[model samples]
Target: MQATSRNFKDNAHRALEDANLQKAMGFVRTGFIDKRKAAADALPEFEALRDAARDIKNHTLANLDRYLERYEAKATETGAQVHWCTTAEDARETILEICRSVGARTATKGKSMIAEEIGLNDFLERNGITPIETDLGEYIIQLRKEPPSHIIAPAVHVTQDQVEADFRSHHKALPADRSLAEPQQLVAEAREMLRQKYLDADVGITGANFLVAETGTSVIVTNEGNGDLTQILPKIHIVIASIEKVIPTLEDLGVILRVLARSATGQEMSAYTTLSTGPKRPDDPDGPEQYHVVILDNGRSAMLGTEYQEMLRCIRCGACMNHCPVYHAVGGHAYGWVYVGPMGAVLTPSLIGVDQAGHLPNASTFCGRCESVCPMRIPLPKMMRHWREREFERHLNPPAWRWGLKAWAFLARRPRLYQALTGLQVRLMGLAGRRRGRFASLPLAGGWTEHRDFPAPQGRTFQQLWAERKRAA
Candidate 1:
């Protein structure tokens, strides 16, 4: 809702105080984690599957160009139009042109982070075309006139009461006497409302989970069957996805699939895993008449040979965010991107520019839960450290922090000074503990003392303890 993600602290403060948001966060913590654990426990080879999945992604990315060309050729052979656009505007313009040719006025859309990356809805709406979100979570946020907060669960910041209130306000045609109760009832109301929109829609757009290069198929997975409706019911279907989603084969897809659901919602697989290869054939009973695959390369090519290339392996499973304590407390909107949590911290800076989003990489406890749970095994904290390095190299860091880092670095490089500093700090903390057990307010630690007390240093510094042991021996 804000113009930029720069006001994270202020926004996080707001999120922390929201009781409704806390309830929503509670569901995410228990519900998502428990579901995934159950799914993982059901499979004896879950860890092995994760390893295989990571290998497939790594292999695919290494030969990305080759696979992409093969995919384009295969897709063309199948009668699907493959459009490659290097920029978001280029991709949007190409899609809009295709829609215009078909006289499409209304479009139904499935959940797509790539679409969010390009701001496609606003672009379509500005041109007087209505773009309707079809996914339940996405639909909720859209009706509430808000941007998605979470990647997997877009409306994770909203409570059930808030959703009911939104549905009542937006679904004005529904009688006031009609009860706005139960998840199922609310779902039925939305299902009925969107069913008409789907039937009447001129164009349907969806994002690909994995683009099978070998078969020229765009794979879309959903818990709801909306992707099927979104693709089939409309006369035309558009699949817009990033180039990085491409995998070599269906066998490779299976490996990733095993880990994807378990890491995200802990399902063996989502309810629907639809693979559409081109448009409807003459023998086909029902499908889109026209199929278009738009491959987006919005700054992704730059990450190809770079240290951040591992990030391309992300399957959008959202495991990292779900396990994040900071995200649980402050919520996804604080990160201010379509992708949030640890992944967002690394990605937002790259996509939005480090100068504008440098603070994101620092918004971490660096607990490494993200890396531990990541199915693709992307070292998120390591990537984030690279962002921090870039920020320092570019001199984009705040002047105060820049000086503080310089001072710390100077001391750290010199062991004598570092040891002396640590000893002094330990002595002062020990003295403070003797008086009050722990420090409520500590000088030179304005950041930590703000919300929490600093634990007293254990009797002595590590260096002091080690030196005394050596002397005794």
Candidate 2:
């Protein structure tokens, strides 16, 4: 919805202080990270698949225009209307127009970040059309009236107790004394509640994980079967996706699929991997009557040839966020955007501009966990560094930060001076903290020292030790 990347520091601070958030974040470490690692380890060709996936995306992006035309021709031939939108506003209005024309009262939605990016729900509501989120995670956040905290696991920030409360609060018709202590119970309750919404929906909307040009198919992979129900039961089905999602062939999709689920949720394949080519054929048993594909570019076309183009390779796996230390500490809402963590840090700036999202790139510690786990092998750290450089160059950073960088740059250019200054500072700090072997508080490092002590430099500077080792060798 609204861009709050500018308030990331404040958001992060609030998140860190939240006990429920801290408890929920435990799942990221204990569940996702370990499961993903095990899943990757089980696959003999996982790394190779990642490389292939990256190459497939690169090829698709390079010939994106050609593939888009091919996709349109094939989809149109298959009785699907393909709408190309250059902006979020255009995409929102187009979906609304389709709904209005059909006299739609409500639409069922699968988990779609593209819809969030375009503010589709609010737009539809304001236009007198109800948008119902059917994906479990999406439905949870919808009930809470909050944006998704994570891309794949939208309600990951929500705990079991909180969810039980939300269900009790929202499902007023349901018995209050029912036992909702378990996750299965919660799922069953939500499933029963949403099943009616699916049946009553006039249109179904979903986001494509991959758009196949050769077959003119839109694909969605989900552990829950909500996406399948969302698209099939409604009279009309609409696939909303960004331009970067288009791939040239089914073979390429096959390669990417080998890595997407493993990297995202540690499954060989999600329980339901649904592909819709077009509206129902005459012989089809059950399907939508109308099929529409809305491809929104937003600002992705501008990133095609730039250094940031590597970011387009992202599969929205959520691996980077799962492995991210910063995300683990404060959770996803701290990013203040639809996308979160390393991918969001780079992509948000591109979509929403670096000025509003300047703090996102700076939020990282650049430990490179994100790049290490990325299925597409996107160099998230490098892209974030580029954003930081852009921020500095554009003078978008605060004066204190600009001055600090300038001061560091001045000394960095001179080898001897840099070494001498650092050596002196290290010696002074080393002596000062020799007794404790750490500093609980430091002049300009309050942020670091606030949580834990800054370890004291042991003795000589690292350069001195390196020089001695080099000479000995």
TM-score of each: 0.95, 0.98
Most lDDT-accurate candidate: 2
Q: 209-306, model 1: which lDDT tens digit per residue?
A: 99999999999989999888999999999999999999999899888988998899988889999999989999999999999999999888888899
Pairs of residues at least 3 apart in sequence or in different chains that clash in candidate 1 = none
Off by over 4 Å in 1: 1-3, 434-436, 462-473
* Candidate 2: tens digits of C-alpha lDDT, residues 141-188: 999999999999999999999999999999999888999999999999
lDDT of 2: 0.93
Deviation (Å) of 366 in candidate 1: 1.2
TM-score, candidate 2, is: 0.98
Q: Against the correct fold, how does model 1 do in TM-score?
A: 0.95
Best-fitting candidate, measured by TM-score? Answer: 2
Pairs clashing within candidate 2: none
For every model shown, the clashing-pair count is 0, 0
The local distance difference test score of each candidate is 0.89, 0.93
